[model samples]
Target: MTTLETPVPAGHRSLRQRAGNAGRRTTSDKVFNAVLTIAMVIAMVPLFVIIGYVTYRGIGVIGWDFFTLEEPPYRRAGGGYVAGFFGTLYIMGLAILMAVPLGIATAIYVVEYGQGKLAMAIRFFSDVMTGIPSIFVGLFVYGLMVSGWISVGFGTFVAAVAIAIIMLPIVTRSAEEMLKLVPDEWRNASYGLGAGKAQTILKTVLPAAAPGLITGSMLAIARGIGETAPLILTALGSVFIVTTLQGDPQAAVPLQIYNGARQPFEEGLNRAFGGALSLFVLVLIMVVAARIIGARANKRK
Candidate 1:
């Protein structure tokens, strides 16, 4: 049998040569870059404007007293967000407690132990959970936690649980991605040293992935802090200082802004602006702290 050989064409060879000989980015690339730059600036302008306006309007009211006082009906007669601040802290503490373990554990299973139909199901549920609205989470907690046994309707604890649900999927997805970034060579090396699967994962993999995991956790916390819809449904609203999570209704900074901004009082408007500015600062501090911690952890290695 004769073998048929195909000869390469000069046109194709010249086309390839010309393609390889092409120089720098043409006009199209520069135009694309210009458009992208404009798009990014446009996307960022509203955020900057909001922060700037709030700071300009509220900086004078921001103080230690502003953080320590209650929101009395008399508006400026009372001081800061002592109850709101403490309530935020309390709710966030509970949310972290609930979200971290569950999120990390789920991430571990998805990354390490996941297989077959079980893995598929877990991934599907996780994706669904991530898309779920915060308001829906609040309603769910209201049904199970509020209407069922606790019968407290709306309170700080319920609000915390709602926030936990919102944060759980974010932390889990972040952790899973972080864990996946761990090098397989490192894992193999650990195994070569007689480390079992669990041991390799706990000692070698986890430490390497800690920075990403913590960064994810911080994002989750930041998201939880600014959430308004969930807290509105689960925590309701309270003007007085709330010392405990179980007994009294607790107001969040977002809730305070919502309630205060609608009133005709000038002081209420000022307080709302101040609260918005304070929340922005708090979120900013958290993001910065996360970056610092992540950097330190990386340096320690």
Candidate 2:
């Protein structure tokens, strides 16, 4: 027997067509994701290789004395990089003291109160500074503070200043971006509560962006700490462990690594490997700390 049926509506046909398109989109998304995963794995290959090679070459050199003794005489095998480690910390601490507050202040002004040519100029120069090579920055500082008649001479303080200059733009740009991420609603709420501009920024905007600020600052420090050329020109590395900031040269891991790499002896080469490994570990620790702090701040929020 023949059966009669109602014609399908245009809406139903369109819905079927949409479902087909959705299915195609799902396939495409999966393909793209797989490609991205492969690319990420490929990119990480070099990092793992480097870390493995360095660990293999340098692990034997790391011990209790490695962290407590200074570099030995030329071509000698029994010594450590205690001086470089401590000097790196000292210079970095000083540089952070000089740069972080100024960078944060500059970001605050640029975001909260800046409105004209001056603000634009500050931003323009900051971007320009970021691209300037470390060697050139070293030269600039050398000319400004070391070479001319008005010289304070090469020392830890001078090196700290140079690193601070290198760090300022990174910190400023990072902080500016973080500050920009803060919502206008938070500021409005603060204003509604009879808070002044300073109070609103301190209590609302800054706390809201604290995680990003810490991460950015830590990353900036990482970049500055790895700089060799600037420290070479400004610090004039010392063999002995120097504690004071002025009138004496300082030791740093990068300088030690550079010097060690130049030596033709096996001991020096081993020291270079050890320094490289130590530096990598230091940076890794800083990055991990930044992640933890950021996570805690997020949870608190």
What is the C-alpha RMSD, rounded to one decimal, of candidate 1?
6.1
Error of 1 at 263 (Å): 1.2
Q: For each candidate, C-alpha RMSD in Å?
A: 6.1, 3.3
Encode model 2's per-residue lDDT on 1-301: one tens digit a residue.
9898667876666433466478889999999999999999999999899999999988889888888888997589969999999999999999999999999999999999998998999999999999999999999888888876559888899999999999999999999998998989999999999999999999999989989999989989989999999999999898788988787889999999999999899888887898899899889899899889878876876
Query: Runs in model 1 with CA error above 4 Å?
Result: 1-25, 291-301
Error of 2 at 178 (Å): 1.6
Q: Write the per-residue lDDT of candidate 1 for residues 61-122, one digit (tens) a residue.
A: 89888887787773564477777787788889999999988999899998989877887887
Per-candidate TM vs. native? Answer: 0.87, 0.90
Model 2 earns a TM-score of 0.90
Q: Whole-model Cα lDDT per candidate?
A: 0.85, 0.91
Best by lDDT: 2
